[model samples]
Target: MTARIDLTLDCANASLLAAFWKTALGYADEPPPPPFATREEWLASFGPPEDGSEDDGAWLCDPDGAGPRLSVLRVPEPKTAKNRLHIDIRVPGHGTPAERWHRIRAEAERLVVAGGTVLAESDGHHIVMADPEDNEFRIAANPAA
Candidate 1:
């Protein structure tokens, strides 16, 4: 038997991280559970915290329903260490080394615009990047893909 899986991210702001991920991955925000007409209706049952942040948790899904579900969980503490596990964004590029680097850099730039920062890069290989919450991930070239 096989088990299904979802990606979970612990961060300070679930909503903000979810938004950034959705834009970066071309995902869509998950709707409220069944019987709730809207997200607001679901939230009203418990009410927002004193700070007035509406989101306590958030979920993002691939628009085509092909990728794993992303669950953003809000936590009080900030990320103090590098991620033990990180995501690698692969961009298909079957060309020269320069072309591959270009593709990777382009993707990294797009992610930067979506709240990610370029940390470092390996020539003709991968670009290490960090999300808004400083979660480390990589953008790499998949030439054989």
Candidate 2:
């Protein structure tokens, strides 16, 4: 059987990164565990971190229930090196290469408004972007095979 998988990102500000990712991927926040009634109640049970560290991160899930779950964690340090692995957002497109690029540009603009910055782009292929905290990701065409 295939093992279930999830994605986790460690960042200086989990909440910000999570928000950016949630918007970029069109995912929804993962609901609280059963019997909790609300996220506040669930979080209250932890009694806060001992050092008073910020804990505003969240777990996000694909609303369609097909993509892997994403968990954001707050870390004490800043990112100093490029990510060894990163997410590539596949946006559906059709028609000529210019048309595909137009779609990508539109999505990239929307993401920029939602807290992502375009780092670079390669014509109709892909656009590299960074989340609020500087973690890199990409937007690319999802052409049918």
Candidate 3:
């Protein structure tokens, strides 16, 4: 038997971030952040970028309700130290390295505009970026070649 596992993110707000991860990983949604009236109604409405989803918390959920979940919690303080752990993403390994890089590059770019930041880059195929709340994640170029 195996134990279920999920990663906890002690950040600033849960509902706000849960939406971003929902799109990035194509995962399902979780309950809306705390303290909102009529949670379901609030969840149905998506806010603009300028707002930064600041009112709600965030989550990097597991779609099937399996696999590791990335839960973002709202904290009173900021992240002042480095993350002790992180997640790495590699697309299906089937194509040229360059193709993988390009595909990954586009995803990374979209994430950046959506409030993610690139922390490091290695050629076109390798790049590191942080989520809206500074959670570090990687998106590698095509692995389908």
Task: Give a tens-digit lDDT track for model 3, residues 76-136.
Answer: 7988877788766665555666767777888888878777899999886678888888888
lDDT of candidate 1 over 16-115, digit per residue (tens): 8988898778889877878998877787778667765557678788888788888888888878888999988889858888888899999998998889
TM-score of 3: 0.70
For residues 60-129, could you state the per-residue lDDT of candidate 2 as single tens digits?
A: 9999999999999887787899999999998885778888888889999999999889999998799999
Best by lDDT: 2
Stretches of candidate 1 above 4 Å error?
Answer: 40-53
lDDT scores in order: 0.85, 0.86, 0.70
Q: Which sequence of candidate numbers ranks them by TM-score, best first? A: 2, 1, 3
TM-score of each: 0.84, 0.87, 0.70
Q: Which whole-number lDDT from 0 to 100 does residue 108 have in model 1?
A: 93
Query: Any runs in candidate 3 off by more than 4 Å, and if so which?
Result: 31-60, 141-145
Error of 1 at 18 (Å): 1.5
Error of 2 at 54 (Å): 7.2
**Ranking, lDDT, top scorer first:** 2, 1, 3
Clashes of 3: 23
TM accuracy, model 1: 0.84
Q: C-alpha displacement of 110 in model 2, angstroms?
A: 1.0
